[model samples]
Target chain A: MLKLDNIKTYYGNIQALKGISLEVKKGEIICLIGANGAGKSTTLMSISGIEPPRSGSIFLEGIDITGMPAHQIVTMGLSQVPEGRRIFPQLSVLENLDMGAYLRRDKEEQKRDLEYVFDLFPILSQRRNQSGGTLSGGEQQMLAISRALMAKPRILLMDEPSLGLAPIIVQQIFGIITRINKEQGTTIFLVEQNANQALKIADRGYVLQNGMIVKSDTSSALMADEEVKNAYLGV
Target chain B: MKYFLQLVLAGLTKGSIYALIALGYTMVYGIIKLINFAHGEIYMIGAFTALIVGGALQITTGLSPLTILAISLAAAIFFSSGYGVTMEKIAYKPLRNAPRLTALISAIGMSLILQNYVLLAQTSDFLPFRSMIPNFPFLTPGKSLVTTTQLVILITTVVVMVILTLLIKFTRTGKAMRATSQDKVMAQLVGIDINKVITFTFAVGSATAAIGGVLIANHTGQINFYIGFLAGIKAFVAAVLGGIGSIPGAVLGSLVLGMTESFGAGYISSAYEDVFAFIILILILIFKPSGLLGRNEIEKV
Candidate 1:
């Protein structure tokens, strides 16, 4: 389980997140959906400790992880696939994935995880030696997610996984996300601008507006809500 | 034909030193994007450490020349690596988020501080450096164009280069370093300690620079506090000429600069040897600013 309590984050003088609170129970796919600059990414970043919240706390599995350094946070089995994928452009796809399990010492387990990720995205295996930058947008996105999965995370925090991908590719990625959650029992905290697809995969969802949560409900209810339908679902 | 071959051999000997020192500049620049002006001082310190350690061992102990050489080389690497890590911590780490110009100024300041510290520690006069390597019995001067020292220096350089390539390509830490150089935040996302990686980079760079310092002292048979200044500047030029962030570029640039200086001095006039290096550098800058092996910055879609 993951919990955020009144977390506020800022970039210099400008506040990007203002006293936001949310939670996700164990093994659930939870999504935070909002438009651009609505602080959805900031929320995940704060939890991941890339940008620590100025106030309040984040707890993962009942342990306070607020304001921890990103590297240390990763050791606690929390991995973030950051916005834009941020894959090492020169590193081969396999090397990029190797970076995900950088802290693990279990060679056999790491090999298993590598196989799991390659199986999840078979296209990645074919391009294992190709540099990450050479991969297409969809392949890169898949690489990014697979790279996170290589960490063997208990909670995977993904930001904008579907951004700039073809609709078919986006659909395929979402289906994989659902499969990853169900099969591995991995808790996912997904942040997205595509509310419709996010809500469809998410067991529960929150509508984030301008650094604050405006609504939280079962994904199906949020999908049908009048305001949510008009604003985010493009109804 | 003999004269030209001799010149090429001389060029390779000089290039061996340049490539070693240039690697420090290129590796540090690759990860942190700082010119690390103080890198030269680390080289100077390496030579001094070797001098002090070797001199003391010769005086107080009856160790064989080979043993003395090994100990002195290790000491040089240890002390130089220490200085490098300390320089990063004291001069650069706090300024990690500061403007790059600020870090560069700090580096320059660190350079001055190191040079002065060494000057105060040891006299400014050139100290004689007895060759670390014993004479090779098989090498006859007239029969072989290369001297024992030059041959040793070349072989050592090749060995070092081969080891470095293996380190950068195969090791886990090496992979982490490559990842960090490419994207620091993403490296952290995967649980790599960025500070540790930065410190490791400084250590590895200084280690190579230390090897250069020891080998150059062995070859030239002399040392001075200010020797690192011109050598550092030349290596920096070589790094830029080869593309500042590329590893192979540094070696290639060093060799190119060395051959130019060697042939230009040998054939034309020795007085303008240094000038040839600068002319080649300027040409490279004017023509291919990225250096031979450097990748142009291509934005991802």
Candidate 2:
């Protein structure tokens, strides 16, 4: 499990997250639904150590990982598929995936993970030698997720995987996310603007508004809540 | 025909050195988008290190020429790479989050500091670089001749290029480097130590520049503190001409620049050789702003 204790993050003098706290239990799909500038990405970034919180601590299992360097956080079994599928445009698909497992020394396990990734996204295998930039948006997103999976992470932090994708593609990606959580037993902390799709797949959900968490409940309850429906789901 | 062959051979010899130095520029530019003006100083230091190590070995020990050459080359590479890494840590790392112009100004400052340090440490006058290779007969029996040293430079450059290409293509560290160059944050999220990769790039680039300094000094038989300035400028021009961040582009640009200078001097006038090189660069830039091998990447919204 991962826990954040009253974390406060800032961008220079401007506060981004004001005493935000959240929890992601093991093997659960937890989604954070918020509008633009709601500090969803900021929360994930603070946890991932890209932008460390100015105040309070983050814990993975029982270990304090507050203010650790980003690379070290990844080694501690956390990985992120950033908002934009920031794949190396010049590198071949295989090389990009290879970079995902950069810290792992176990060759056999790496090979197995690579095979699993290829199987999960067959398009990646087909275009294994092509440059990542040349891929379609959906394909690039798939490659990004597959690349993150190559790390064999205990927790995968995905920021807007459904952003800028077609509805069908979004459905497919969400299905994959669901399968990943149920079958692989990997904990996921998903941040999404698509509340309808996200809440459907998530076991639990939290609503963030203006750098603060306003609601947290079971996904079904959040879906049924009149305010949640009006504000987010547009139901 | 023989004269043409001689010009081509000489051009290749000079081109190989430019290519070596240009690789350093391109690699650093690719990773951090810094021009690294101090890179030339690293080359000068490399030549100095080789000179000191080779001279000391000759005076203190009775070693074979080949052994001395190996030892001196290794020392130069090691020392120059260390200087490269140090320069990055002290001058560039602090300014990583600052504006790009700040880094550029810092690079120019670093260059001045390195040049002055070398001038104070070693004499500003040109120092002779003794040939390490044993004498060998010319490949051709005509006026247009190929010496053993020219052959050595060409062969060494080719071998190094091949090895570098392989390193960037097949290695895990290379993949990490490519990843870092593409997106530093994503690379970190994937558990790559960005600082380590950047340092490795600087070290490898400096090592190549070191070898270039050693070979070029040996070829010309003289080196000075200010030699790196002109050579570095020419190599920078080559890197830009080839597409600043592309590896093969750097080599291509160097060869083209070298051939232009050689042919210009041979057919026209030696005094206008540098002009010829710059003319080619300007022409290339005018026509293809991205350089010969560089792709104009479209920004995805």
Candidate 3:
């Protein structure tokens, strides 16, 4: 579970998130849909401590984690699959996954986690020895998601996981995300511009526009809303 | 042929020292993107630490020469790593978020401060470094060959190189370091303390420089406060020549630079040895830009 109350974030003098508030319950796949530069990524970054909120507080499982360093935030069981799949280009696939579990010390647990990840994405196991840069776009996205899962976080925050992905690949990724939430019982806070697909899988959704949450409702309700359909779904 | 073999041997001996020092430059540069001009001073401090420790051990204990050498080398590495970590904490860490020029100027400033500190603490005069290993010079057909010191330097360098390669490839800390170097923010998101990795880089890099300082001081039998200045510049050039952020590139560049200087001095003119080294560097830069083993990374827009 995570909660942000009246969070404000900035890039130098320019404000990105102005008094935005949101919440996600445990084991729920909550989607935040917004146009480009609509504070979606900024919200995820604020939670991850990459861009600390200038005002307001963020609570993860009732514990305030607003101003903690990014590394500390990760150790506290929060993981972010950042935009553009920032996998280490030079590192091998296995090394990239190893880095995901960097905070863990138990070798047996790490070995089990590695096996679990490989099972989830068999392509990753096949290309375990290859450099990350050599992987295709779909494979790279899988690696990025798999790398975050290697952290075994209580909640996974993903930013634009579907960005630039092919249509069929996007479907496959979304299916995996659904399975990860259902089977693993992992809470997901996903930010996406692919409103149609996101709304299809999400239990609840929020609409963001120019650094503000314009609408919040259950996925079916938002899908049936005329304004939401016109603006986000392009239907 | 004998003369050529002697020059190659001499080049290798000197190159080993340069490669050791240049590794420090490449690694610190790779992680932090700072030249760390103060690194040379770390080497100078390492030599001084070894000298003092070796002298104290001789006077205070009746230890064997081998034991004394090992103890002094360890002390030198420990102290040099300390100096390096402290320098990063005091001089470079604050400038992490600052502009690149600020860090560069700070590194030069730290270098000067360290040099002056040594001058005030130790004498400016050249200090004699006793040969820890006994001389066992084996002659060749044309009266050209290797000494025990040269053999020791080569073997030690190779061993250190292998160990370093293994450490970087097989160890978790090394993997964290490589991750941080590639993507600092991403590394942090994955629970790696970037500060710890950076600190480790400085510590390990400084340790290698310490080994180089001790070996070179032993071989040359003299060390002055300014010794690090020229050596530092040469090592920097070697790093740049090999591609500033690539480890293998640094080693290869140092060997090439060392061999060039050795052959130039032997076959051409000893007076212009440094000139030959610089000329090679210039030629390499003009032609390759990226060092021999360096990858030319295209910036993603």
Highest DockQ: give the candidate number: 1
Query: B117 in model 1: Cα distance from truth in Å?
Result: 0.9
lDDT of 2 by residue, A1-235 (tens): 9999999999999999999888999999999999999999999999999999999899998799999999999998999999988888888898888888888889999999888888788889999999988899999999999999989999999999999999999999999998888878999999999999999999999999999999999999999999999999997
Worst 10 residues of 2 chain B by lDDT: B135-144
Sort order, lDDT high to low: 1, 2, 3
- The DockQ scores of all candidates, in the order shown, are 0.89, 0.87, 0.80
Worst 10 residues of 1 chain A by lDDT: A41-50
User: What TM-score quantifies how close candidate 1 is to the native fold?
Assistant: 0.98
Q: Number of clashing residue pairs in every model?
A: 0, 0, 0
Q: Residue-wise lDDT of candidate 1 within B212-244, one digit each (tens)? A: 999889888999999889889889889989999
Error of 3 at B212 (Å): 0.4
Which window of ten consecutive residues has the lowest lDDT sum in model 1 chain B? B132-141
Alpha carbon lDDT of residue A11, candidate 1?
Answer: 97
Please give, for residues A87-121, the per-residue lDDT of candidate 3 as tens digits.
89999999999999898888898899899888888
Instruction: Give the lDDT of residue B75 in candidate 1.
Output: 99
TM-score, chain A, candidate 1: 0.99
The residue pairs in collision within model 1 are: none
Choose 1 or 3, whichever is better by lDDT: 1
Chain A TM-scores, one per candidate?
A: 0.99, 0.99, 0.99
Model 3 regions more than 4 Å off: B136-144, B299-301
